[model samples]
Target: MNELYKVDTQDPVGEVWLLSDFQNMRTELCEGERCIYPNDLTKTLFHKDLPRFPLLVKYICANDWLSVQVHPDDELAKSLEGDPWGKNECWYFLQKGRIAAGITRQEKPLEDLRNGDLRILTPERGDLACLQAGTVHSLGPGSKVIEIQQASDMTYRIYDWGRGRELHLDKARVATKAAASAIVIEEMRKFDWKYFSIELTKKVEGSGIVITLSEVPELHVLIDDREEFSEEALLVRPGSFWSELL
Candidate 1:
């Protein structure tokens, strides 16, 4: 997702996979362009043949505004795209400002409701937004977001603010919710769906401990290039991920 449209140089890392849907993901193991696919883990977790990762996690840092868009709900997604799962995502704001969420209903055309019907919510650092399926949303400049969403990338554009992308008014009319579905997360931890969960780690011993509350059976820690954990130099960035140190 290294699009030329991305604005911030510090946030050039648009997307990466912690684990991925196997068809599109490859891992490097050797100097001779060795590639390994992550099909085994994803298959064992879901117990089915999947095209790609079931959950997609990424960081979205926008130096400028993004296109106003909406994702299809489960039923519509299945009927139209033949995909049983629709996208329901939540955003954890690292740097926050104005982000458009939800919609205001008017009896007019879909194009008219694009800008006028949206509401802006100001979320500071550590705030979360759980966006249900079919909620229309957009991100503005100076916003750094950590997004976790269902694997489907089916987006129906209402309007792009003149970005000139093709607008999907027909599908958007069926997909968007009439009442606003965007939620400003009121709780520190929310279990929205079975696909994933979001929780804030408490400050332990005056140190922030960020942990994932997953039902997965084991915590396989990798250290010193091995599949194990040991006391070593551990690094954490508040809003970003860096695998190496300079």
Candidate 2:
């Protein structure tokens, strides 16, 4: 995707944050002919007490297996990491491939199942995999996806496939659940998720990604002709969003 999009980077580009509003990393939001950073639009776009944007969008391109990880829910997030939000993400596959999601057998120890002891699911292009918080998952090699999730990035890495990275087994053990739910594959269209809702469409031409807020008068659109991803998302307001595919 980096080569296809002509993005120049010194290191391998694993993830591209399309829309974000964290304190350290922020994406510009365009309203009409004006463009402003999301952090600066809090007065008009967010409530006075809200900390950050409600949703996050990213383009993930993996050539190898990603870390097997899990995320905490709202209660766990606040108690463990002092974060206001937890990550409950969905992946919209751009390329047909496989993914390691959920444990294959319920009785096996999670530590013993760290090395690829998970169910392998094959999802074709345009299929969406909804992964709620605490669901253990890993993206397979040669898979590209558009990820939509809560604004937080609280990931607890259970395994790194012998990368020697620090493991969070203790926290992961507490956050892990035997059978929260299985990943569901469905066609991408409109999704009314717990944290946020998304509506997808295809565009022949015009802007790169346009986000229209349903309740607010303001419209935030991301315009970048250089971006050539198969699909990209636009975050409207909290609990509402719009996505487009080129």
Q: Name the candidate that leads on lDDT.
A: 2
lDDT of 2: 0.67
Off by over 4 Å in 1: 1-36, 47-51, 202-246
The Cα error of candidate 1 at residue 10, in Å, is 15
Q: For residues 57-141, could you state the per-residue lDDT of candidate 2 as single tens digits? A: 7778898899988889877988999887677888877778678888767677666665357778888876888887888888898
lDDT of 2 at 198: 56
Local distance difference test values of all predictions, in order: 0.58, 0.67
Name every residue pair that clashes in candidate 2.
none
What TM-score would candidate 2 get against the native?
A: 0.77
Model 2 Cα RMSD, Å?
Answer: 7.4
lDDT per residue, candidate 1, 141-237, as tens digits? Answer: 7776667777677888887778688989888888888675667764334443455655453222221112232211111211123221232211111
